[model samples]
Target: MEQRWDGSVVLEAGRLLFRGRLGTTHAHAHAAVQVVVVRSGTVELADRYGGRLAVSAAVIPSRATHSLHAEDAQGTVAYYDSDSHVGRALRSRFPTAPGDRVTDWTAAAVQSACPPDAPGGGRAAAAPHPAVGRAIDRVRSRLHGPVTLEEVATALHLSPSRLGHLFAEELGLPFPAYVRWVRIRRAIELVRSGATLTQAACGAGFYDSSHLTRVVHEMFGMAPSQLLRDVQWEPGPQRIRPSGPGLAGAP
Candidate 1:
């Protein structure tokens, strides 16, 4: 039989897939487009301005501040980089701005919009700029330490100003924002391994547990304590094997 888990997180070059139970959330927003595919029950979302929606499956645009309430709902939440083709396609099909678009969608429609995965686990049809790619590599390698745009630019033989421009142009987000997202991802991995909030915070290069808490809450709309509790975590293809307490059903 296929294994089941309380939660599973799969990371790729340009995508992050999370599957499991969801609880009521605080209002928050991040820099990626979110696609939720529901397997059962309904997901009720409220925007920062009092807009409300109940969806089985939905696509939320990047930077759209919203709170989610899903008492018994279980499904997959896939986050795609705003610059990736998938992200662009989703925005094109859905056509809504931040805080304005949380339209209901279907699994088949989402899958159809997703192009074939490129080699090496990248779903982005277009590769990032050469400098941006190198910068990403450098950032990934130094998630546990300070990584500055100037340092990366110097190493790549480019000026900090130029590198920053390229990052925004190619990734659709600022360099610092990208680094913060990476740190968040790393922290989540650490939490899934049973690390305490402080430990995970330090491991992911946050100043302290409080900093991590704030970032997680702002980006994901939930504190780590609630999101990582009693969940089995599955890392990406390049990381360690899946291990942790299991959920009751297949995700």
Candidate 2:
């Protein structure tokens, strides 16, 4: 943390990975859901209608736009892949709430739910439509290079529009957006395996390190350095394991 700001961080990751932080952030939205838990002090957030809501613990749904302000507060904010088991588990933490911020924080508690072993546990592909599955396979195969929607559509003998529609309908996001996520996922994995930022960026299709940083900040509301600076990770089965609460330096 910078001198002007007083903030501490704690990041623990696994195949069921997550990034937790205790700090403030400008307005931003990410592709993944975020679980914001204020252990001591309270934080304020603006809802959809621009109403200021105070909360200690809440589940911010994926892609939900919001900003936070926390100073000298003991809190834990965990970003979860909404498609993962832990993400679904956190979403179910709240009672019936139409909007963000679990209204009655005292009444409900949020827990990180997952198996002892993951990345292979409970992640059996809930396979998408056969065509979509095949499309995804193609994307994974061409991850090291460029694989546009048109090329994928042509390969599958389907019109671009039909393929785009199928991607949105079956995956709940556009083809390009999904591709970007895959690239970021690969980049993160490369970093976990001791690759430098620049190397990870180029290896994962990002133009450079700065390009990767901007995309990550736009998606996760924080620069990758702020998030990964203190994380000392060790390569695991299919993920990286942090040495402890907050490793002092990068791996």
Candidate 3:
């Protein structure tokens, strides 16, 4: 699914971003828990077994199978490393995910997702340890390439075992798992930037388009065809906007 660069920001150290109109995603699950604050319109989140709920804003637990939709729903989606201190904090903040509406953190978190750059980025938080943050940056720096944790650790003058622990203890997600997720995200971004699936797959470190397709569906739930169905994107000065209109009513 390739399109022009939609006006969205990937911000707050890769933990927060604005989900633009890529239409509905295929049924998928995520490795990291998510908090979505609907800005313009209502969105319906449907679970795998067909159960559904309509909410203005929602917190979704990790590994939960679900898909979100609205004709043109726009929102800030924040992701937390499932094992990080902040990720653990979110459980308390939400209390009831995929069912709970955000009460306190949405406003601040959504604002934080927006930055000067469209598809923008910022430095990671120096939590858990600076080394862990550095490792994350290194992985993110290479969108397409096989980078082992050992390599990253070696570069940082640490053993693979110690660095792997940093990833787990500090970031919550292990080095390998985090790297996988980053590759998937990178492929999606490449597709959004107008690359074909094959190109995106290669550019984002996948073995092939088939690999990208399968993983995208697994991680995000939406199949490639479904996600790419009507993706509209652009490179622009992005800003927070109301979801506007589409898909509503308690499902």
lDDT of 1 by residue, 11-122 (tens): 6656766666544656887767677666777677776668677766666766667777775677766777665677666656543223354443332245444532323323
Q: Each candidate's lDDT (Cα)?
A: 0.65, 0.57, 0.57
Q: In candidate 2, what residue range of length 10 has the lowest lDDT sum?
A: 242-251
Measured against the true structure, the TM-scores of the candidates, in listed sequence, are: 0.73, 0.69, 0.61
Q: How does model 2 fare in lDDT? A: 0.57
Which residues of candidate 3, in runs, are more than 4 Å off?
1-27, 38-56, 61-124, 237-251
Candidate 3, 160-241: lDDT as tens digits: 9999887766544568777777786677567666788899899988888888778767776555555454445544522222
Give RMSD (Å) of candidate 2 vs. truth. 5.8
What's the CA error at residue 178 for candidate 2, in Å? 1.5
Best by TM-score: 1
Can you tell me which runs of candidate 2 are displaced by over 4 Å? 1-16, 19-21, 37-39, 47-49, 72-124, 234-251
In model 2, what are the clashing residue pairs, if there are any?
Answer: none
Backbone collisions counted per model: 2, 0, 13
- Deviation in Å, model 1, residue 74 alpha carbon: 3.1
RMSD to native for every prediction?
A: 5.7, 5.8, 7.1
